[model samples]
Target chain A: MIQRRHALTVRVTHWINAVALILLLMSGLQIFNAHPSLYWGPSSYTGAGPIFELAGGFPSWLTIPGTQWLAMGRRWHFFFAWILVINGLAYLIFSIATHHVTRDLAPTRSDWRSIGRSIADHLRLRHPQGEAATRYNVLQKLSYIAVIFVLLPLMVLTGWSMSPRLDSVWPGWVDIFGGRQSARTLHFVIAWLLVLFFFIHVFEVIVTGFWNNLRSMITGRYRIEHEQR
Target chain B: MASGGVLLSACDAASRNPHVTKVLSIGEFLSQHVQHAVTSRTALAQEFTEADLSPEFRSNGTDYPDSAEYRALAMNGFVDWRLRVDGLVERPVELSLDQLRAMRSRTQITRHDCVEGWSAIGKWTGTPLSEVLALVHPLADARYVMFYSADPMDDWGTRYYESIDMEDAYHPQTILAYALNDATLPIPNGAPLRLRLERQLGYKMAKYLMHIELVDSFARIHGGKGGYWEDEGYEWYAGI
Candidate 1:
């Protein structure tokens, strides 16, 4: 039996986010390469220098222009940032309006109880099959919820916190994250966390039937191996 | 891109896609309009105390302008230097360094955020630009104030320049800084005068000042883009 996995909206938004995030990351690196350093506290120069100062910033191929071009890099970063925000907002609205959150995303009491079993199964590369395979597992729900809800929004806020004009409109708001530099640090850290999630996500996709997962995302069809319940 | 060389041939041959850039510019357009609309008229950039000042104020791009005109003025301690205020103004004024110093001043300690994502805080003391505007009353048609700097950005003698709208022109924190860290503004830091556009990125702060031209539009200016960097494809609005 072929399970209808992802909704059309989910598939569309997921691809949009994929492209937007990749461009954002690349262009972000190009911007980072300008100063090639990260700091803590309210400012970069505390007489202590930066904690995460890179002599030569992120290399080419990782950066959008594949060379240092802060001006062009900024253009690309801000452009895709709007794409990310718009797509994410659309996804959020759909999730809420359709009760997709409660139906699929929110972890259940049973999922909480099955944590140990889920961990064991994951460690052994033994994924659920047949009827169970149709739904998201406990770990999948948790990671997706965390990334979509917590990390993405925080990154956006931190990004805004760095803007001087925004800081003027609401002074001391950035102080919540320690300061602009500290907010900047948090932003960079969150970006890496997202990258880590991406790698793990791709790895999981490969392990749990690559083509099955890929097809499910692209065509919303995942063929469950066994016909019997 | 300030000093970052475009090293790859791909940057020119492949990545200089006009359609891609045009599409990207819509992002710039939206950001400028949205941010400008939302920003309050009374909103002021954050100011800090003496304790927040950087131990050593660092500068990028043309610390000490090596131009013959700038060098001559510096040699005479800027006594001969004059800040030309002309263009769309009723009274074209050429105020000397001493005259500018005699004017009412406002000093503030603020962060200088570079487009490259680094920031440094410094104390700046200078004549508020509103005071200058009063002296040379801008014409009703004037929309932008062009700042001509002493530092030449290119071998072809294209000097550094910047411009701002009248809203910023009168912002209290927006000043023509002649001093940094309570000392005479260092040569590398724009010397006789520099713009302190507190709400924008550092590039918007033109240094080593020479003239102030109030214009209805900057279309007739070099490259007709308003600023030296703007011509090079950077956004005219650097508030973000």
Candidate 2:
């Protein structure tokens, strides 16, 4: 039962992705305050809600005196977006060039059945691995593949739907996505999925064995416990 | 990571070589152009609550004009500033701030999106662009209206300038903003005159009013595109 661990490159990429995503989400929330409601909702509403208010709904700290809430949000959002983009691109390019994305994360054809079995084992509906599979035990490969290929790419495309270009060059895209307003709504929903993914990934790591996983990622090695048959 | 992906795709979409694409390709232009109304109807959206506005909207590009002409106008409180509404118009009027203020007004609370991927909602008060256009009476040849501002970019030795098409020119929310938050537009915020085209991003809203030229096409205009960013890598039709 020789156990392998995350490589240094994978460890760095994971942490970079984690930090960039957090900043992007926080700043993105500020940007969304401009038009709060999901576009598909009642047309009666457009641009509602407080981006930031005092504890008592009072203005006591660093108030600009006579500025609008949306304006301030714009400043923060624009500045933070630069950080998120540069950081994210670095990690993405590095992962691809290093073959981490293609090699370790992507799922194979057999992963279809193994993923279901792995889920059963994780939930304790079945015993741990039968000492048969090498590398990722199906569930890891499936989740990683889904995140890298499906969710992240969807997030990028839906985000671009907000651009004015969506109307001019690709009215077809707008039609396919229902409409521009609907695309904005989808972007918000997908962002929530990313937020959920972050928490669950972290919580699962802790539950499985926090110190072990953390150290393996950081140091790139883990002790193997071999049970002699 | 998600937001990063968003920025990447957006830049990819915005990518273009300014030289070859003299004007934003209609197909590429419309891809991002905010399709306000299929018909050529111009109207203003609803006004916004004071609470809905952002606290600090940072100024981008040139904050103040350096040209002697603009400096003199600003020094005189822009009372003498004349926004020449000429070219392809029936009246070819030269309007004063006082005259503009006297006209029928349209107030709208709309989101101001920036190319940098940030947005803000603010209440803008001004005459509907169409109202001003009516006085000019665009000629049958006029297919685009170019906005020339006093904000100088001083490219090498020449000055910087920008323009827009008729579609954006007549958007319901498009206005020659003179007031912000119910006060005289501040200098830093393009006082005396600035555009508030709600659908397009902030860069398209050229500040420091000077002239509005009605044109048949953008071919002869500076760079032959629309906006300064369009002369660079940005898509001229930045509708969001």
- Listed models, DockQ each: 0.56, 0.07
**Clash numbers, per candidate:** 1, 25
Q: Rate the local accuracy (lDDT) of all candidates.
A: 0.89, 0.62
In the predicted model 1, the residue pairs found to clash are: B63-B188
Q: What range of 10 consecutive residues in model 2 chain A has the weakest lDDT sum?
A: A58-67
Tens-place lDDT digits, model 1, residues B1-240: 432334333433335898878888887887778787888866899889899899988888898897898899999899899999999999999999899999999999999998878899999999999999999988899999999999988789999999999998988899999999999999988999999998999999999999999999998899998899999889898878
Per candidate, native contacts kept equal 0.64, 0.08
In candidate 1, how many Å is residue A83 off?
A: 0.7
For model 2 the local lDDT of residue A123 reads 85
Name the regions of candidate 2 deviating beyond 4 angstroms.
A1-117, A120-161, A164-229, B1-30, B33-47, B155-157
- Model 2 interface RMSD, in angstroms? 12.6
lDDT tens digits, residues B93-209, model 2? Answer: 999999999998877665565654444556678987889998888988898877888876765534445567787777767789898877888877887888887556678888887
Q: For candidate 1, lDDT tens digit of each residue in A152-219?
A: 99999998888888888777788899999999999999999999999989999999999999999999
TM-score of 2: 0.55
Q: Count clashing pairs, candidate 1.
A: 1
